[model samples]
Target: MATIAIVYHSGYGHTAKVAEHVRSGLEAAGAQAKLYTVDAFVDAETGPWDELAAADGIIFGSPTYMGSTSAAMAKFLELTSKAWFTDGWKDKIAAGFTTSGSLAGDKNETLQRFATLASQHAMIWVNFGAKPGYSMSNSDFATVLNRAGHFLGLATQSLNDLPPEQAPDAADLQTAEVFGQRVAEATKRWVRGAA
Candidate 1:
């Protein structure tokens, strides 16, 4: 079975909720999934570096802040430079997801940050494979997947006033689950191919 690690920084719990749904999907797909908080990796010498290195895949998650990943997430990415130097994550499958206060929250930039980081470490970056969910006139706005139409990775929206429990809604959560499954399946194939 594939082992995937979800590394994230959820400032207000919205991203954390998305991570949980993603984990559910990964588990459903027969992959072992674990969630790790950015706070635990603030110090390079500390945290579960070994666990991350052992993971077959890693999905990065963070709340979009100022049109990019959160500061905490950025710090974590920066700290990965040590790993980059040693090619610790080379050939591993990598993916990303983000939550924002607005629908078009420049979330792509955050995903780009993740992809670029993965590229720097010689990892394969996975895109959100599902087509846009609200492309048709008859499409239901409330129940469609990939409603925001982001291709680079999963992007979800939440109202600033509403709490995490209610803002992301069922559609976005379900979308995240699907995304997780896709990544897990892809990782499994990639691992088999490598073997």
Candidate 2:
């Protein structure tokens, strides 16, 4: 089975919730999924480097802050320079996801940041693959997936005032599942092809 590592930083729990759903999707698709907070890899000398290195794919997640990735995620990205120097993650499948308060919260930029990180590490970046779920006037927000219309990766929205439990709704979580399944399947294929 393909092993995927979901490395994420959730400031208020919403992103973590999404990551869990993503994990479920990965497992459903017959892949082994592991979740790791950015803190796990922040300390270079004592990090879970072996676990990540063994992963066939990696999915990055973070709460969008100031129209980009959070400060914590940025720091984590910088720390990955060690892996970059060693080509540790080369040829692995990589993808990303993010959440924000607004429906159109410049979230694509954050995914772009992640894809760039994957590119730097020579990883194969995977797009979200799901089409926009709210493209038509008849579509209902409550039932639609990929509501934010982002193709780079999973983009979810939550109200700033609402707690994580109430925001990011069922639809966004379901979309996250789709994202996870796609990545897992892609990783499986890539791994087999490489073998």
In TM-score terms, which candidate is top? 1
What local lDDT does model 2 show for residue 163? 93
- Candidate 2 clashing pairs? none
Could you give candidate 1's per-residue lDDT for residues 1-195 as a string of tens digits? 899999999989999999999999999999999999998895877889999999999999999999999999999999998898889999999999999988888999999999999999999999999888876584886999998889999998887899998979899999999999999999999999989
Against the true structure, candidate 2 reaches a TM-score of 0.97
> Could you tell me the C-alpha RMSD of candidate 1 in Å?
0.8
User: What TM-score would candidate 1 get against the native?
Assistant: 0.98
Q: What 10-residue stretch in candidate 1 is worst by lDDT?
A: 132-141
RMSD of 2: 0.9
For residue 148, give model 2's deviation from the true position in Å: 0.4
Name the runs in model 2 displaced over 4 angstroms.
none
